[model samples]
Target: MSKKKIKADSTIGLTLKTMVISPIALAYLVYSIFQSQIQSFDSISTSLLLIDSGIVTALQLLLFTKSAKKVSLTMLGILQYISPTISLIGGVFLYHEVLTNAHFIAFVFIWCALAVYTISSITKWRQEQMKNEINMEA
Candidate 1:
C-alpha cells in the first residue's frame, strides 16, 4: 500500500480505540458515582452532585468522541483540556474559588495553544479546499 494509505490506516486504528474507550470510561464513571453514593460517603444532596457529574461526563465524552474521530489525538487532548480549564475559570471567577496567578497563567497557555491549533487547521483546510477546486478546474 501507499504511504498515505498506511498513515490513514494508523489514524483509523487510533479512532477505533478512542471510540471504544470513551463509552467505557463514561460508564465506569457513572458506576463509581453510584457506588460512592451507596457507600454513604454523602447524603441525597451530595449524591445528586455525583449523579449530575456522571451524566455530564457521559454527555461530554459522547460529544468529544465524535470530534476526536475527525481530529488527531493531540488536538483532541487539548480540546478536552480546555473544557475543564474553562470550568475551573468559571468556578474561580463566578464562585470565587480563590483564583491564583499560576492557575490563570496555565489556562492562558492552554488557550494560546488551542488558538494556534485552530488557526493552523483553518488555514490548512482552506488551502486544501482551494487546491481541490484548482484540480477540478484543471
Candidate 2:
C-alpha cells in the first residue's frame, strides 16, 4: 500500500516483463516460420545479433527510464558498460577465444570509468531522495 512498496512492485513487474519479452518474441518468430522447410544459418549473423541486441538495450533503458523514479541515465550507462565488459571476459574464457592483455586492460579502464559514473549517480539520487523526504516532512 505504501509508495516504496508500490514502486518496488512496479519495478519487479517491469523486470519480469522485460525478461519474458525476448523469449516470447523468438517463440513467435519460430512459430511463424514453422511452415517453411528451408532455413539458412546466415540469417543469424553477427551483425544481426548486434542490431537485435542494440535494440533490446535501447528498449531496456527506455523502460527503466520511464518506470523508475530515482535512477538516472548515468547509472544505466555505467551498468551497461560494466555488464558487457564482464560478459565479454566470460565469453572469451568460456568460448576459448583469443584475449590479449590489451583487451583485459581496456576492460579495466572501462570498468573504472563506469565506477565513477555509478558513484556519482548514486550520490545524486540519494541527495534528491533526502531532499524529497525533507520536503514531505515540512
Per TM-score, the best of the predicted structures is 1
Give the clash total for candidate 1: 0
The segments of candidate 1 whose C-alpha lies over 4 angstroms from its true place after superposition are 1-75
lDDT of each: 0.71, 0.68
Tell how far residue 59 is off in model 1, in angstroms: 7.3
Task: Write candidate 1's Cα lDDT for 1-81 as tens digits.
Answer: 322234344445556766888899779768987777445445787778877986786666556545555676556566667
1-138, model 2: which lDDT tens digit per residue? Answer: 322235455556656757889799778768756857435434779657767886887677657555444554454445556567677868887888787899878877877876786688789989999999999999
Decoy 1 TM-score against native = 0.51
Residue 103 lDDT in candidate 1: 76
Q: Would you estimate the TM-scores of all the predictions?
A: 0.51, 0.43
Task: Determine the C-alpha RMSD for candidate 1 after optimal superposition of all C-alphas.
Answer: 7.8
